[model samples]
Target: MKGNRRSEMSVTEMFSYIQGFLSADQDVREDIRKVVQNLEQTAREILTLLQSVHQPSGFKEIPSKCAKARELFSTVRTQMAELKTKFPVEQYYRFHEHWRFVLQRLAFLAAFVVYLENETLVTREEVAQILGIEVVREKGFHLDVEDFLAGVLIMASELSRLAVNSVTAGDYSRPLRISNFINELDSGFRLLNLKNDPLRKRYDGLKYDVKKIEEVVYDVSIRGLAKEPESGGDK
Candidate 1:
């Protein structure tokens, strides 16, 4: 009888432990959701601001837009910093899913700002710096490589659309520059041994972006809107 009583006590204790664990998990997730919501809001603002690049006179406003986006990223960093504190450092992966999508959006926004300001691809390290996260996984709450690549792919697509708008805005030279940039970016992507399905899918979409920009460049070149490349080879 005593043995059966002990067994019942053990079973009850196990369930009690599990219930407590589940409760704690729920609380942490709720906190994380709140932080992630803030991050998403800031990301949306940045995206909206950057979308002006496709406007008729958007090129003229890039500098100001980039500056505003930078200010929004500062808010993202603060929210990310708060997110990092919601869960234990060692459990980064455990809670990362809650913020993964937002992180990718933030990465894309940072990349977009960098490109608008400097016409250069923002490095993964630079994205992390902009989002105020660590570059090293061991340091906790770091940006994942896949997320960065996804952002770059998204930026490439945006650039493709920008190439079309640049022509409408009477900036034929910009398409040629965009074509070269996308080509180089495509080549760099081909060199990676990507195993992530989502990232690989994004990489595949890059070819379409490449083709679209190429068509823009071709149309611009054939119409004599842009200077022709030298006869020998690409300059």
Candidate 2:
């Protein structure tokens, strides 16, 4: 009877432990929250830009990609400015600092790597979308952003595995997954620069959503990578 009671308590304790760990997955929550916030900013800035371009804003249900892009550009510039001002995180394990960054970059990479390694060809529309590519129109297909996210999510898993190590290395306010994404993102931005187009110079001036995201990504990464503040200097 005593053994049975002890076993029951052990089971209960195990359940509690599992729940506690799951609930306290701070990195998971933080990464997700950051993603959500960035998406929010994207939507807002995109809206403002689109409105400016469209005049009526919602005259048509499906707007042109150019209009959408213009909208995307408008708010991203301003939002990024605000993000740069709010230096929330101290360490930049994920960046020079923390901000609205990808929780999905590493994961996206991981999933893509696996699909390639396994010779698994993606057939779904959603899978291709998250990869930031065009997809085929299939019969009876409800293709949408969800499909892309699904594909990207597969990569995100691998990213999480590689990135978690960095977080373990650093204390709170440092996440390596975020750092890796930012680093890659920073490289991507510089690589995409065009110098010859009519709007090349203007593009440089107009804030890309990429740059806004960078601010947050760099912010987090900076906090993680920054040298700890010197102690006993003047205070």
Candidate 3:
């Protein structure tokens, strides 16, 4: 009877240990969610700044606007770094989808800043470094391609609007350059046999962006305003 009672007690203890393990897993996820939410809020603020920066601002003012957005990006990057360190073991990829929206937006903002400054597209590798994340393949996690591509799509739309706004603000050369940039991006996207549904939808929206920029270019060219479309390469 004594041995049987001991065996039953051991079974109960093992069950409790399993329950505790599951409970800890839940706690970890909850903690990650809370942090991600905070990061998401910050990312949204940065996006707002990026979206608004090109609106009738002086060229001298643009650098300040970009600087402010970069400051917020730095904070978001720090939070991401912390999350990477504390992300529950074996659950990094699983939890990554939770933060996908914010991550993609952050990626867009990083590239957008570069685009605004240099009129060039930021490469995926440069964005990964800016975000302080690795692009590991074997038994390691990397920044999702779909996320970065989504950001670029979003950038395309913004640049379309920027093209129009730049013309209004007396930067005539920018609209043609922007039109060319969108066309090039559209061509690259068309080459990909995309399987991601959300990415495909965003790629579909690229046509609208392309058309809008084309209209802007046509309007400028009809008025004899824009210079020749000589800036071809992505610097």
Candidate 4:
């Protein structure tokens, strides 16, 4: 009966659990390269989707986002591969959606990667600069970086929540939190459509919220704050 119940569980969750159990077993291991390839392939799928669409022009038109998403997934895949090599891909209980594991896992990784990039790679001023320039700005760009980061933070916050919820609540008996994850992505996608008000003649699409954006960089902010002032303390 437990086996039957397990059969109904999520593939991803199962894989996660199984990976945990056989941590010492070397026979069922996954290759890091294979995981990376899977991650890269999915990213290409997203890029192809965008290329087919007529995206709006603007500084916010981060054309490389797809590539970045792929890279992030690749990182997670690499982690999974290592873990799987040490463990197994099936958990005793169900916690993953077998069919959608790739995408869901990718979403978490993509959001995580975005969170990191928001900290180290992109800056609010740089984002603002992108919006300020006429060539990029005129096409329809402006943003409230705050709004987007809210979604990312929400997404990251849920990772812990979902993981716990799965173990304690056994919610993985069903679909788990995929909807919320997708909602986070939707938040990002919606930002794609927002054009700064026509009367304002500013493209909100390219605008970024400094405070909200700062949330995603929580770790980086801590590091930045921890450092001594470049000039040193008061004399």
Best by lDDT: 1
Q: Model 3 over residues 13-113: C-alpha lDDT tens digits?
A: 99999999888877778887887888888878877777665666544466677888778878877888777765644566777777788878878888898
TM-score against native, each model: 0.94, 0.28, 0.84, 0.21
Please give the lDDT score for candidate 1: 0.88
In model 1, the Cα lDDT at residue 188 comes to: 96
User: Could you give the C-alpha RMSD of every candidate to the true structure, in order shown?
Assistant: 3.9, 24.7, 3.9, 21.4
- How much lDDT does candidate 4 score? 0.36
Tens digit of per-residue lDDT, candidate 4, span 1-235:
9987777777778888888877633333334335445555665454343332122221123335535445544444454444334323333112222212343333433443443234222333343332131113232222234332332433444333333332232222111223333344445545555345331222222123222223323432355532333221111
lDDT of 1 by residue, 53-124 (tens): 788867788889999999988998899889988998888888878988888888888998998888889998
Could you tell me the TM-score of candidate 3?
0.84
Instruction: Point out the higher-scoring one by lDDT: 2 or 4.
Output: 2
Candidate 3: residue 7 lDDT (0-100): 94
Q: How would you encode candidate 2's per-residue C-alpha lDDT over 140-162 as one tens digit per residue?
A: 11223333343343333333332
Q: Which stretches of candidate 4 lie over 4 Å from their true place?
A: 1-61, 92-106, 109-153, 156-235
Q: How many clashes (backbone atoms < 3 Å, residues ≥3 apart in a chain or on different chains) does model 2 have?
A: 40
Poorest lDDT segment (10 consecutive residues) of candidate 2: 53-62
Best of the candidates, TM-score: 1
Ranking by lDDT: 1, 3, 2, 4
